[model samples]
Target: MEITFYQEVDSTNSEAKRLVDGGKAPGFAVVAKRQTAGRGRFDRVWQTPTGNLALTFAIPAPPSRPDLPTLALMTGLALHNVLQPLLGDRAQVKIKWPNDMLVNGHKVSGTLIERVGKVLYIGVGVNLVSRPENVPYETFSLAEVVNITVEELAEAVTAHWSATLAQWLETGFAPLCDDYNAHLYGRGESLRISLDRERAEWAEGTCTGVTPEGHICLADSEGHVTRYNAGDIDIIRTLQSV
Candidate 1:
C-alpha cells in the first residue's frame, strides 16, 4: 500500500484520480488531515475537519467499469466490517444503500467513487472526532462513540480495505450484498426515502438488500419491491439522513 499523507487538501478523491490518470497503480491511498472541499455521494459537500479519516484509493484494474457502484458498496462494507466490532452493540452500525455508514440511525461516515478510464478512485470520509459544522444530519466519530484513537481505526481500515477490494474485484457483488445486507439499517421497517431533490417519498415494509447491479431494494407496504439506483435516501423513523 502506497499512502500519501497530507496535512490538508481539497479532496483526496480528486488527488488520487489525478494520480491514476497519470498512470498510478491500485492499492494507492491518499489521506488528508483536513479536506477543504470534501464531497459525498451525489456531489454533496462533506464538511470534514482535521483529524478525520479522509482517504481515496485508486483501483487500476476493475473487473468491470459499471460495477463501480458495487465496488463502492463493498468498500463501505469493509469500513463497517472493521469498525463494527469496536462499536459493539451500542453504536449499531447500519449501512445505507450504495455507500453510507450510519450509527444508531445517524450518519457517521460516507463514501464516494469517481472513475476515470478504467481506474477508479474510491473516496471515504469518516468522522473520527468531530462533525463538520452545520451539517444537516447528526454525525458521530469512532473515538467519540466507541472510545478508540483515530490512528487505530485508520490502521484497521487500511488493512481491511485491501482485502475487501480484492474480494470485490474477483467475486463481484454477491458476497458484498450478503455481508452488507446482514448489517443493513432498518431491514424490516416502515421508512420514508428521499428519492430526489430531498422530497420525502414514503415506502413501507423492509429492505430486501440490493441487486447485483447495486440498486437499493425497498419492499413497500403493498408487498412490491422498489429498487433505487443512487440518490438521496434516509431512514424516516429516526429522521436519520443518509
Candidate 2:
C-alpha cells in the first residue's frame, strides 16, 4: 500500500495509469492535492478544490474477469464504510446505485473504475473541504459536517478499498449484497431510471435491493422485479404521471 503524493496533477487516475504503463506494480495509490482535469463517471467533470481528495489505486485485474458494475458497487461500499464512521450521526450517508456517495441526499463523493490491460484503476473523488457550485444536482462536502484533512481521508479510503477488494476476491459480491443494500440510497422509494444515455427511454419502479450479481432491482406495480445492469438512477422526490 505505497501511496505517492502529488502537489498537483492532471488527474490522479491518469497518473496511476501512467505508472502502471511504466511497469509499476499493483497495490499502490496515487493521490493528488489538486487535479486540473478530474473526471467522474461518463467523463463528467469532477471539480476538485485544492483541499479536497483525489485518489486512484492501481490493482491487479481479477482472474475471473468479474463484472465491472459489481466491482464499482464494491468500491462505493468501501467508501461508504470509511465515511459512515466519520459522519457518525452527523448526517445520513447512502450509496447511490453504481457508485455515488450521498450525504443528506446530496452527492459527497463518487467512484470511477477503469481497466487497463491487466490492471484496474479505481479513482475516487471526495469533496472534503469544498464542493462545486451550480452543478446540475445537489452537492455537499465533509467540511460542512466534520473537520478532517485531505491526507487523513486519503489514507482511510485506500485502506478500506484494499480490505474490500480482498473480501470480494476471496468470496464474491453475493455475501456483501445485504451490506450494500442496507446503505442504499432511495431504498424502497420510487426511482426514475433512464435506460439510455440519451434519456429518451425511462423506467419507473419502487427500488428493491440489489441482487447478488450487483444489478439494481426495481419492482413494478404488478410485483415483477426487473434487474438493470446499466442505467442512470435518481430518486423521485415528487409524484408525477409517468
Candidate 3:
C-alpha cells in the first residue's frame, strides 16, 4: 500500500510499469494529478488535462489465474463497489462488461491493465471534476454531477478498492460477479458487437452477468448463450464512438 502521488506525469500506468519492471514490490500505486498521455484499453488515447484521477498500481501475479483479463474485471468490480456509495442515484454508475465505467450510458472512467512478468500493472482513469468535450461522444465527471472533492473521492476509492481486491484474491470471481451484475446497466437490450476488425454483428440479448473466469455472458437472439473473453471481442457502445 505504498502510494505515490504526482502533480503531473505522462501516464501513471507507464510509470508504474517502469517501477514494476524495475523490481518494485507488489501493491505499489503511482497516482498522477494529471496525465499528459493517458491511455485506455486497446491503446486508445484517454484525454485529460488536470482535475481528474489517473492512478495505476502493480500487483505481483499469483501462481494461479495468470491471465490479465480476469484481474482487469476484478479491478472493475472493485471500482464499482468503491464508488457506488458516493455516486448515489444521480451519478448512475454502472459497469459495461469488461471494464468500462459508465454514467447514464456515457463513459466516465476506464481501466487498462498490463502484465510484465509476474507483476500486473493496473491503470484507472476517473473523470472527477472536468470531462473532455472534444470527441463526438458522451462523457461524465463525478464532481460535475456531485458536490464531492477529487481528494475525497480518491481517498475513499483507495481504501475501498484495496479491500475489494483483497476479497477477490482471497475468495474468487463468483462473488465478485454477483456484485458486478447488481450494478450492470444493460440487462436486456440489443447490441452491435464487433466480431473482429473486419466484421460486426447485431445481437439481441439479455445480459446474464459474467462467467466465473470473468467473461461477459450474453444470452443471444437464438436462445443460445455465449461468453465474451475480454479483449477478444469489442462490445460496441450503442450511443456513440467511445
Candidate 4:
C-alpha cells in the first residue's frame, strides 16, 4: 500500500488516474487537501474544503464489475463502522444507495468508483470542517457531528476500508448484505426513484432490502418486487418532488 499526499490538486481521482498512467501500480492511494475541480457521479461538482478529506485508491480489477454494488456497499459499511461509534448507539448513520453517506438524513460522506484499464479507482470525499452551500440535498460535516480532526477520521476510514475490503474479497456480498441493509438510509420509507438520470422520470415504491448482488429491491404499490441496478439512481424524498 503506497500513499501520496498533495497540498492541492485538480482532483484526487484525476490525480490517481495520472499516476496510474505513469506506472503507479494498484493499491496506490492518492490524497489531496484541496481540489480545484472536484466531481461526483453525473458530472456534479463536489464542494469539499481544503484539509478535509479527498481520498482515492486503486485496486486491481475483478473478473467482472458485477460486484461493484457490493464494493460500494462495503465502502459505505466501512465508513459507517468508523462513524457509528462516534455517533453513539442510537444515531442513524446510514448509507443512501449508490453514493451518499447520511447521518440522520444529512450527507457527511460520499464515494465514487471508476474503472480505468485493469484497475478500479475508488474516490471518496468527506465533509470534515466545511459543508457546501445550495446543494440539492442536505449536507453535514464531521466537525458539526463530532469533534474529531480530519486526519484522525481519515486514518480510521482507511483502516476500516482495508478490513472491509478483505472481508468482501473472501466472502462476497452475501455475508455483508444484511449488515449493509441495516445501515441503509430510507430503508423502509416511500421513495421516488428515477432510474438512469436524475431528471429522467419518477417511479414510486416502498424501499425493500438489497439483493446479494447489490441491486436495490423495491416493492411497488401493486405489491410487485423489482430489483434495479446499483448505480444510475436518483432518489427523491417525497413523491411530490417528482
Candidate 5:
C-alpha cells in the first residue's frame, strides 16, 4: 500500500477520494496529523489534534456485501481487537453497530467507508491523544488513560484490518458477524430507537442482533420484529446501553 502523509489536511477522505479519482491505484492511503474539515458518518465534523490518528485507505477489492455496511463493521471489529489488548483486560472496549468504538461507553473512535465509482475509501479517526470538547456524546482519549503512541496503535490496527478485509472479501459478513457480535455494546438489551431522527417517534425493543444483510434487528415488546435499514437512528444511551 502506498501512503501519503500530511501535517494537516481538510479531510483525508476527500484527499484519498481525489487521489483515487486522479488514477491513484487501490491500496493508496492518506494520513494526516490533523484535519481542518474531517467528517464522520453523517458528515459531522471530526476534530483531531496533532497526535490523533486520521487516515483514509483506498481498498483494492470491491465490497463483499454491498447490501450490508460490512466495511464499517469490520473496521470497528479490527480496532476493538487491537485497542483492547493495549488498554488491558480490565478496560471495557466494545463496538457500536455500523462503526463506532467505545471505551466504557465513551466514544474513542469512529469509522466511515465511502464507495465511489468502483473505488472504496475507508476513513477512520481515533482519539489517541486528545478529544474535542462540547460534543453531543461522551468521548475518550488514550492519552488520558494509557501509555501508547499513535504510530504504535496505527500499525496494530492496520495489520488487523488487512487480515479482516481479506476474510470479508473471501466469504462475507456471515463468517465475521459472530466475532463482531462478541464485542457489541448493546446486544440483548432494551434499546430506544428512532427510525426518524427528525421526529420523536421513538420505539423501544429488545436488541436481538444484526442481520446478515447489516440491518439492526429489534424485537419489540409485542413480539413483533423491526429492522432499521436507513436514515438517522441512534440507540438511546441507557444505564446499560453499553
Candidate 6:
C-alpha cells in the first residue's frame, strides 16, 4: 500500500489515473490536501476544502470483475467503520445506499469509483473541518462531532478499507449485507427514486433494503419488489435528502 501526498492537486482520482497510465501498479494511493477540480458521480462538482480529505486508491480489478455498486457499498461501509468510533454516541452515522456516509441525516463523506482498463480508481472525500455550500443536499463535517486531523482520518479510512476489501474479496457481498444494512439510512422508509438521469421516470415505494449484490430494493404499493441497479434516491417528504 504505497501512499503519495500532494499539497494540492486537480483531483486525486485524476492523479491516480495518470499514475496508472505511466505504469504505476495497483495498490497505490494518491492523496491531496486540496483539490481544485474534484468531481463525484455524474460529473458533479465535489468541493474539497483545505484540510479536508481527497484520496484515491488504485486497485487491480478482480478476476470475476466484481460489481461496481457492491464495491461502492463496501467502500461506504469502510468509511462508516472509521467514523462510527470517532462519533461514538455523539450522533447517528448511516450509510446511504451506493456511496455516501451521513451523520445525523446530513452527508459527511462520499465515495466515487471508476474503472480504468484493469484497475479501479476509488475516490473518497470527507468534510473534516468544513462542509460545502450551495449543494442540493444538507452537508456536515467531522468537526461538528469530533476533532481529528486529515492525516489521522485518512490513515484510519485506508486501514479499514483494506480489511473490508479483503473480506469482500473472499466472501463477496453476501456476508456483509446484514452489516451494511444495519447502518443503512432509510432502510424501510418511503423513497422516491429517479430512474433516469433526466428524472423523467420515477419509482416511489418503501425501501425494502439493498440486495446481496448491492442493488437497492424498493417495494411498490402492490407489494411487488423492484431492484434497481442505478438511480438517484431521495427520502420522501424530506428537504435536502440525498
Instruction: Using lDDT, give the best candidate's number.
Output: 6
Best by TM-score: 6
lDDT of every predicted structure (CA atoms): 0.76, 0.87, 0.73, 0.78, 0.77, 0.89
RMSD of each predicted structure: 2.4, 2.2, 2.6, 2.3, 2.4, 1.2
> TM-score of every model?
0.88, 0.96, 0.88, 0.91, 0.90, 0.96
Native-to-model Cα distance after best TM-score fit, residue 51 in candidate 4, in Å: 2.8
**How high is the lDDT of residue 156 in model 2?**
90
Model 1 Cα lDDT, one tens digit per residue, 124-227: 88888787667777777776666665556666787798888777777788867777878877666655566666565544446677777888778866789988
Steric clash pairs (candidate 2): none
State candidate 1's TM-score.
0.88
Clashes of each: 0, 0, 0, 0, 0, 0
Which ten contiguous residues of candidate 3 have the minimum total lDDT?
230-239
Pairs in clash, predicted candidate 4: none
Superposed Cα deviation of residue 71, candidate 6 (Å): 0.5
Off by over 4 Å in 3: 21-23, 66-68, 197-204, 231-242
Regions more than 4 Å wrong, model 6:
66-68
lDDT string, candidate 4, 1-242, tens digits: 56787888998899999988888778878888788898887788987678678989888887765676678878877888888897785456887885568876778887888888788899999888788878867778777657876566767777778888988988898898888888887678776666556556656678887888888878887889888774433355543320
Query: Residue 18 of model 4: what lDDT?
Result: 90
Model 3: number of backbone collisions: 0
Q: Higher-lDDT candidate among 5 and 6?
A: 6
